[model samples]
Target chain A: MTQKTDQDYILEVRSGNVNAYAILVTKYKDMMFTLALRMVGNREDAEEIAQDTFVKAYTSLSTFKGTSKFSTWLYRIVYNTSLDYIKKKKRVILSEHIDEIHEASIGTMQDAMSYLEAQEKKETIERALLQLPEEERVLLTLFYFEELSLKEITEIVHISYENVKIKLHRSRKKLYHILKNVVEPIYLSHGSRK
Target chain B: MEAENKKLDQFTKEVIQDAGLSSPSVDFLANVMAEVSKEESLVKAQNPLITKVGWMIIASLFAVFTFVLTRFSLGFSILGDWDLSSLMIEKYEMNVDIPITYAYCFFFLLVFVIIQINFIKKYFYRSLKN
Candidate 1:
C-alpha cells in the first residue's frame, strides 16, 4: 500500500478524523525538535517548543490554505514558537564569552591548545557549532543538515532571499572561525610549520 | 590564511551535513495527541446548538404570546399602546387589542429572556476561557 501523504492526513483532519493528525505529529516531531534544539540550545526547551508547535498547528489547521507545502506551514509555526521562546528568555546564548561556553571543556588557554590537539574532527565541529550564535547554528542546520533550499528557508525565517544569502555567508564565516580555533592547534601539534 | 580558512569552511560544511537531525522523547507524539484530544473535547462542549435551540424556543413562545394578546382584545395601556396589535391588524386586516395580563406576562417573559441571554453569554465566555 502507498503511504498516505501529508495532504491526505490534513483532509482527514478537516473532515473530523482528529486521529489522523497523530500521523503528522509523528512524522514531523523529530525535525521540529531538532530545529527547536538548534534555536533554543537545550533538550527540555526544544521538546516543549516542539509539543507546543504541534498543538498550535492542530488548532490552526483550518487556517492552512494549502498554498504551501504542509511541512513549510508547520515549520513556520515551529520557527516562530522557538523565536518567541528565545525572546522570552531574554538571553541570547551567543552572548557568552567563547571560553565560558557551557560545552567548552577548555578551562585555560593552555587547555584549549591541548584539547584541540586531541579532539576528533567530528567532536571539534560539534563543539564549534555550539560555540557559535543561535542564528548561525540554525541557518547551518537548515541549509546543510536539513537540506532546505535557500528560498524555503527564507520563507521559514521570514527574511528576503538576499538577506538569507548574506546571513548564510556570514554564518559560514562565523562557523569557520569557531572551527579554526580548534583545528589550527592540531596542525601545529602535527609539526606542520605554517 | 585564506587557504586555511577555505579548507576549514569546507570541513565545517561537511560536518554539519553529517550531524543529522535530533530526536525527541519517544512519547512526543502521544503527548501531542493527548493535548489535541483535550482541545477537541473543549470545542465539542462549546457547541452552539444548545444555545441556538434555546433562542428558537424563546422566539416561538414570544410569537405565541403576541398572537394570544392581540386575538383576546384584552387591552392594556402599559404594553406600548397596542402598537404591535394595531400593526398586525392593519397588515393582516384582523381585529386585535393589547391585554393587561398579556402585558404582565410579556414583561416577565422579557425578564426571563434577558436572564437567559445573560446565562448563554456567560456560558460562551467561560467556554472560551477553557
Candidate 2:
C-alpha cells in the first residue's frame, strides 16, 4: 500500500482493496476506543465496541456516499455501537467500584509530593469523569476527546445542534463541579508539603 | 450571559486539552483490522442483490412448506377412509379420499404465480404502460 490520502484511501477501499481498510482502522481506532470507553466505562467492552464499529463501517461503506466526512461517519458507528452494547449489557447503573477508585485516589494523593503527583492528577480526572451521567460523559468525550464540533456531534448523536450546545454546557458544568468539589478539594487539602 | 459563555468556552478547551482522548491503542487497532478483514471476506463472497433474492427464495420455500404440511394434515382428516361407497358419496357430496398432493401443489403454485405476475406487472409492465 503506497501511502494514500484519505480520499484515495476511501476510493481504494470502495474499489475492493481490503488492505486499504486497515489504514482506516489504524487511523481511527484510538478515537473510536475513547468514545466507546467513555460510553460504556469499561476497557474490554470499549475495545470490543471499537472493533465492531470498524467492521460495521466497512460493511456499510457503500452507503456513505461521502456526504459526511469519514470521521463523522466513523464516529456515528462508534456511538451507535457503544449505545447498543450498553443496552445489551444493561450496565447503566454506575458501580460502587468506580466510587471506590475515586475515593482511593484522594487517599493516595496525600503522600504524593513530586512527579507522581501529575500521574495522580490524571487518575483523579478519569475517576471524576466516571461519575458523570452517561449522556454527559458521552457528550464530553465526543466534544473534547474526539475534537468533534458541536454540529458534528449533533450529527453523530442525532440531536439538534442547539440541543448539543445546551447539553454540552450542562455536562461541562457538571464535570467542572465534580472536579472542583469531589477531586480538587481532596488534592488541595492533602497533608502540608514535607 | 456573556461571562457565563466565556467561562464555558474556557472550560471546554481546558477539558479537551486535559482529557487526552486520542484514537485507540495500537493493539486495539490490530484487533479491529483483523475483524474488518474477516468482514470484508464475508461481504465479498456474495452480491447484495443475490443475498436479497436468496432470502426471498428462502421465505417463499418456507411458505410453501408450511402450506404443504397444513394441507397434508387436513387431507388425512378429510379423506382418511378408502372404500368404494365412500369414494362415490365423496365424489357427489364432497367426501372422499384424494391424495391432496396435487391440490396442495396447485394452490401453492397458483399463489406463487399470481404474486410473481403481480410483481412483474407492477415493476416491469406498469412503467411501460405509463
Candidate 3:
C-alpha cells in the first residue's frame, strides 16, 4: 500500500476523520517542535507552540486552498505562532547586532567546526543557536538544517526573497560568531585532555 | 575572498545537518492529539440549532409580542374580513395606559440591549478563544 500524502490526510481531516489529523501531527510534529525550540530556546514553550500550531492548523484546515505544498502552509503557521508567542510573553531574545562581529571570525568557523566530534559538534550548534536572536536563528535552522531552499524559506517566513538571502548571510555570520566562542574551549580540551 | 565564503557556507550547512533533528519529550504526540481532540469537540459543539444571538433575538421578539398581546386589545387582519377566530378573540380585554416609567424602562432596555449584546459576544469570544 502506498503511504498517504499530506494532501490525503488533509482531505480526510476536512471530511471529519480526526484520526487522519493524528497522522499529520505524527509526521510533522518534530519539524514544528524543532523549529519552535530553535526560536524560543526552551523545550516547554517550544512544545506548547508546536501543539498550538497543529491545533490551529487542524481548525483552519478548510481555509487551506491547495495553492502551495501542505508543509509550506504548515510552516507558515508554526512560524507566525512562534513569533506571536514570543511577543505575547515579552521574552527577551537578546537581539544582537550582526555587523559588529569581526570578519576574521567567519574564517575560523569552518575550521573550528571540522575539529569537533559529531556529538560535540551537535551540542555546539545547539548552544550557538540559543545565543542568536530569534528571527535569524529560525532562518538558519530552515535554510541549513531543514535544507529548505531560499524560495521555500520565503514562502514559510513571508519575507521577500532578497531579504531572506541577506538575512541568511547575516545569520550565518552571527551563528559562527557564537560557535567560535563555544568551540575554542572544546578545542583546547581536545588537545590537552584527549 | 569569495571562495572562502562559499567554503564557510558549506561547512556551516554540513555542521548543522550533522547535528540532526531534535525530538520533543516522549509524550509530545499524545499531548498534541489531545489538544486537537479537545478542539474538534469544541468545533462540533458550537453553533447549536439556534445560536446565542438567535435565541436572544427570538426572546426579544417573544417578549414584545406577549406585551402587545396582553396590553392592547388584540386583533388580527390577514385579509378583508378573513377572521380566523382563534387569533380573532378580543384578548386580554384591557385598555392599558403607557406609564412614563414603562417608556423609560423600554428605552433603557433598548440602549442596554445593544451594550448587552456586545458584552455577551465579547464574553463568549474570550471563553471560546482558549
Off by over 4 Å in 3: A95-111, A192-194, B50-122, B125-130
Leading candidate by lDDT: 3
Model 3 agreement with the true structure over A28-85: per-residue lDDT tens digits: 8888898899888899999988888888898899999989889888888989999998
Better of 1 and 3 by lDDT: 3
lDDT of 1 by residue, A16-62 (tens): 99999988988888889988887887899999999999989988999
Those runs of model 1 whose alpha carbons end farther than 4 Å from true positions after fitting are A93-124, A184-194, B1-12, B50-130
lDDT of 3 at B78: 50
Candidate 2 structure quality by residue, lDDT tens digits, B1-130: 5665565556555555566664555587677667776666554543355577799999999999999888766545554565557456545776566678988998999999999987885565435423
Candidates sorted on DockQ, descending = 3, 1, 2
Residues B1-130 of candidate 1 have per-residue lDDT tens digits of 4654455445545668656667898888888898899888877866777588899999999999999988987665566645575466467766778899999999999999999998998887667746
> How many clashing residue pairs are found in candidate 1?
1
TM-score of predicted chain B versus true chain B for each candidate: 0.36, 0.34, 0.48
**RMSD values, in order shown:** 10.0, 13.8, 6.8
